[model samples]
Target: MAPDYTLDRNDELLIAVSLFEYSREWEIAEPWNAERAWFLCRVICERHGLSPSEAVLELE
Candidate 1:
């Protein structure tokens, strides 16, 4: 089922910034750290009731 809850502006901004940092780390960090960053990004999306794709759409 879809989540009924919605993020407020501050939460959205926080998530967006976190996502961006995670993505950056995924690109530039060592392989192990990159993997960790990727995992964290997924966790963040899941915790917020979003799929990675959905999170991207929300950022747009």
Candidate 2:
């Protein structure tokens, strides 16, 4: 079973930034996907109660 809740693009960027900055382990790799990053960011924030970035998402 996976965790609940979904994340928008802004949310995803937040996670990518977090992982890239904090988790050096993930940064070694070159070029990361925004979608994957968003998923990670969402999970991390959800677990740590870290709110997503105020940045809004413009869905296409």
Q: Among these predicted structures, which one has the highest TM-score?
A: 1
Predicted model with the maximum lDDT: 1
lDDT of 1 by residue, 1-60 (tens): 987998785476467557656666667656666666667767777777876677777766
The superposed Cα distance between candidate 1 and the true structure at residue 11, in angstroms, equals: 4.7
Which digits, one per residue and each the tens of the lDDT, describe model 2 over residues 1-49? 9899788655655554565344444544633554465566557555644
The weakest ten consecutive residues by lDDT in model 1 span 9-18
Show the colliding residue pairs in model 1: none
Q: Give per-residue lDDT, candidate 2, residue 13.
A: 53
Clash counts for the predictions, in order: 0, 2
- How well does each candidate superpose onto the true structure, as a TM-score? 0.53, 0.35
